[model samples]
Target: MNIDKNSVVTLHYEMYDANNQLIDKTEEPIAYLHGGYDGIFPLVEEALQGKAKGDVVEVTLTPDDAFGEQDPEMIRIEPLDVFPVEVEVGMMFEADDPETGDVIIYRITDVADGKAVVDGNHPLAGMRLRFKATVDDVRAATQEELAHGHVHGEHGHHH
Candidate 1:
């Protein structure tokens, strides 16, 4: 079946950085309720429209279209005592955004001199990405799936 609005699409995808280094790949295919439900990247959804099983698509995304540009302001240096003693580089934790009061995930990038550098930007932020996907199956989405704005069953959301 063609992938269109309300279609349930199953596909395998590989994500690579600008350097062509594989960042992520689906070991098992994934399914999503197609057409603007935000189930996948908008650009990718657009590329998949009208495609059928066995079709392949490759798209290059700029930083803005992918994880977004890195915000220098998002990086802050805080007193080490503010974080757990176990905090170390590469550790991620959630904290409230002082400006918006929304929860923001921050990753520790450095620790020294009683201070820790925490960055709120997504790890992939500021980088271009290449996405490659192969359509494995396509079918009309069930009413329940459409109502939920997502796909259900194997390779999809469980609940």
Candidate 2:
């Protein structure tokens, strides 16, 4: 079957940045909800539509289609006391949203004598991405899988 909404797709993919540096890869199949939910990037889901098993595709997505453009507001400076004493540059910590209690990942970019600069933007937020993918299998998703809004099997549910 071709990949479509609610279809279960299994594929191996290599992801690269604009610099052509490898970011990630999957030797094992990566499965996800096709178009039923936004489990994967919309650009990728759109590209896989109507494609069947064994098809290979190369797709490129801009920042807007991927993680999105970097927002300057996501960068903040705070008192060093806000972080643990041992926090160092490049360390990541969760900063909770006071109202929603949602935890956002923030990376410590700079730590000076009495202040720290934390950035909440995703590492690849402003970069274009390239994906080289080979579709391995495509099948109708089970009702349970659809109910959960993700694909489940080898690598676990992809949310």
Candidate 3:
């Protein structure tokens, strides 16, 4: 079946940075609701439209289309007391951007005496991306899945 609005799509993908260095790859197939459900990248969704099982797609995404450009303001050094003692590099937490009041995830980049460096920009931000995917399955989305704006079952959310 063709991937369309309300369709659940299963696919395996590998992502590479602009320099052609592999950054991420799906170990197992992942499923996402097709259409404008925000379940996947808009560009990727557009590329997959009308595709069916076994179809392959390769697309390049600019920083703006993927994770957005990195913002220097998103990096800050906070007082060490603000984070748990166990905090270490790579630990992440949700925080509100003090300037924009928007919620963002902050990853600990450094921990030092009385200070901790956190960055709100996504790790892949500012880099162009290339995606190569092979469609594995396409099926009509369940009513529950549509209502939740996501896919269900294997490679999907549970609970």
Candidate 4:
């Protein structure tokens, strides 16, 4: 079946960096609701439009199209006391942002000089991404899946 609105689209894909270095590859096919459910990247979903099983697609995404440009303002250095005990690099924590009234996840990037350096930007932000995928399947989404705005069951989310 061809990918269409409310369809469950599955793809076996690989991601690469601008330098041609392999970044990530799917070991199992990843499935997402097609036609603007926001489950997949806009650029990729656009490319997959009307695609059928066994079809191949290749696309490149800029910072804006992908994770977005890195925001330096999201970085903050706070006193060690602000964090939980035994803080270490690569740990993630959620902190309330007063400016936006939103909880932002911060990753501990450094711990030094009685301070913790945290960054809120996604790790892949500011990097160009290249993707290649083979369409594996496309089937009409069930009413429940449509209502939930995502795919459900078999390689997807469950109740």
Candidate 5:
């Protein structure tokens, strides 16, 4: 069936960096609730609209459309003692954003001189991305799936 509002769409996608280097790809077909549910990128959803099984779509996303530009303000240096235990580079911790009270994940990028440098920006932030996807299936979403704003069942969310 053609993809449309409240449809459950299944597809596999490959993501590449601006250099054409492969960044990520789905090993299995994943499903999402279509129609501006935020389950998939808006631009990609737009491209998939009215498409049917076996249709392919390719989209290039700027930093803003993708992970977004890296924010220097998200980086912070804190005393080593502030950490609960020995911290190493690449470790991740969750903390509340002082300004918004939203949870933020901070990754330790450096450890030295009794301090740890943590960055909250997504690793892929500030880079252009190319997404190519092939539609594998499309069907009407179940009432529960639509109400939850996501897909559920095989390759979908489990309650």
Candidate 6:
């Protein structure tokens, strides 16, 4: 069957950055809710439409098509004293917003004697993403799977 809305697709993918550095890869097949669900990116779903099993595709997406452009408001500098003594650059920590209690991930970008710069933007924000995918299987989703809005396997659980 062809990959289309509500179809279950299993594929292996290798993702790269504009610099050609490997970002992520699937050791096994990854499954997702296709056609605008929260599983894969919309652009990728659009690209996979009508494709069949064994098809290999290489697609490049701009920031707008992938993760959105970086937002300057996501960058903030806080006094170094606010963090624990052992805090180091590249460490990710969650901070709660005072008004909403929403947790946000802040990655330490810079550290100095008394201040630190933390950025909350997605690591890939503002960068192009190149995806190399090999479709392993494409089939009609079972009624239960469709109702659950995800895929179920031999283990009898939805992924």
Top-TM-score structure, candidate number: 5
In candidate 5, which residue ranges exceed 4 Å CA deviation? none
**lDDT for position 26 in model 4:** 91
lDDT of 6 by residue, 31-65 (tens): 77566666777767778999999988788989998
Per-prediction TM-score, please? 0.93, 0.89, 0.89, 0.93, 0.95, 0.85
TM-score of 6: 0.85
User: In model 5, how large is the Cα lDDT of residue 48?
Assistant: 100
Q: Which window of 10 residues has the lowest lDDT sum in candidate 5?
A: 144-153
Root-mean-square deviation per candidate = 1.3, 2.0, 1.9, 1.3, 1.1, 2.6
lDDT of each: 0.94, 0.86, 0.92, 0.91, 0.95, 0.83
The CA-based lDDT of model 1 is what?
Answer: 0.94
TM-score of 5: 0.95
Model 2 spans with C-alpha error above 4 angstroms:
99-101
Per-residue CA lDDT of model 1 for 27-65, tens digit only, reads 999999998999998999999999999999999999988
Residues 1-159, model 2: lDDT tens digits: 898788888899999999999998996888887884877787788888999999988889899988899999889999977655777899998878787788989999998878888999999899999988899999898999988888787765744
Give stretches of model 3 more than 4 Å off: 97-103, 112-114
- In model 4, what lDDT does residue 38 have? 93
lDDT of 3 by residue, 53-116 (tens): 9999999999998999999988999998876566889999997767888999999999898788
**Clashes per model (N, Cα, C within 3 A):** 0, 0, 0, 0, 0, 0
lDDT (C-alpha) at residue 53 in model 2: 99
Off by over 4 Å in 4: none
